[model samples]
Target: MSSEQQSIKPTEKQQILQMFNLLPDVLFWIKDIHSQIEYANTVYLEQVGVKNLEQALGKTDYDFFPPHIAKQFITDDKKVMDGELITDRVELNSDQKGNIAWFLTSKRPIFDEQGNITGSYGITRHLEKNSQVLSDVQAINAPVNFIKENFKSDIKIQQLADVAHLSVSALERRFKKYLMKTPKQFINQTRLEHARRLLVETQLPISEVAYQSGFIEHSYFSKQFRLLFDEQPSEVRNQNQSMNMKV
Candidate 1:
């Protein structure tokens, strides 16, 4: 081989990872046991708002994602590292501009030569570009849209089922099949996401945020918020204020 050709040969791992960059709709990433990013494809980097690998390395999801979203990611990472394989898990992801979207993700634990766990890797496919998956879930669109539009109001599972033109049982089955969450869970998630946005964007009191987000009981809202985000509602507001002051 010529000297230049020999110098440019890609290693097997490099060749494999490089191929992922060619898949425009897929975000590929690897992370350590600590949930620190080790490597990511170009698409993943762009989604996380980082310019390059150097900027992404060693950063946890908390650095790039909203706290609740990052908590979900890290929880999955922990499960994978504990030897569970997560397949085609439907979840929400947000971009740099805070535009949220649904994504289908699968993750597996990476093993060393001796069969010892080293870290984890995963691929996330953007659902918007996946026509097949989207078509399969088209039946649920009506209910999903209704939830988004009416999350600030009292929502019930029966209401969602009615909107989807399905019986409550059938709606529950379809939600579990396609979204991996029950109708009730989806309703709360939508409301919590709205509450989170209001908390960050407005100076309203925490109780007011909860009320405006359709949460009737302030104590219940705080409990669920902490369960999902791994912190109290006040903490999120305090952190946001601290960040603003530093700017």
Candidate 2:
């Protein structure tokens, strides 16, 4: 049994679950190996327009999302069931009202006592269009958007500060306060995220991928990739290739 299943009494488990439901910006859910929704947090119910857990239990993505998006979700779930962990995938999801929002998602397989995969669980954190804890994030939205758009080029901190209409020092302060990263760190993070996607989804040469990811030097790109991922970019490509071959 899992720790929650073993140690927590039913009432206590329910109370802990209620705490998870109160998290405003996160949608959490678990699915069976067949992709049936087993559990969904309160935020998930609100997003899908469900009145209660009963309305969502045993439903699949098809019940909540458009067909195209549902297919993508099932594909990811299948990967998790196959013992692959999917992390930090940025996606645009449409809500019940057809409003689209961006989210950062992650998934991992749930295992049984025998260590066999039983199902999957994951969380998606909303990236936009909600009340932000950092008020300055609203003011810096333009520069953040600009950084995302221009991360593949030679982006400068001064250019970002100018775009945000803040001084260099002021922009650094706000970026750190709102994003928890300095402007340069944010830029590198953006570039690295793009590089990760390209490495997995495309057959581009590593050097070209690095260049397109805004790393002027191949050595520096490799260093940064190792620092963030703890593995060479080549290993990521190799893993993806292996998964593709099996598919």
Top candidate on lDDT is 1
Q: List the residue pairs that clash in candidate 2.
A: none
Worst 10 residues of 2 by lDDT: 129-138
- What TM-score does candidate 2 reach? 0.61
Clash-forming residue pairs, model 1? none
lDDT per residue (tens digit) for residues 32-70 in model 1 = 879999999999999988899999999998799766567
User: Which lDDT tens digits does candidate 2 get at residues 1-247?
Assistant: 7887767687786787678687888889989999998888999899888999999999998688654356458778987898778776654456546764456788999998999888999988877745553243466777888987898888888898899898999999987776667889888987886787788778999999999899989999999988866678898789778867997
Which TM-score value belongs to model 1? 0.76
The top-ranked prediction according to TM-score is 1
How many collisions between residues are there in candidate 1?
A: 0
lDDT measured at residue 216 in model 2 versus the true structure, 0 to 100: 88
Tell me the lDDT of model 1 at 68: 51
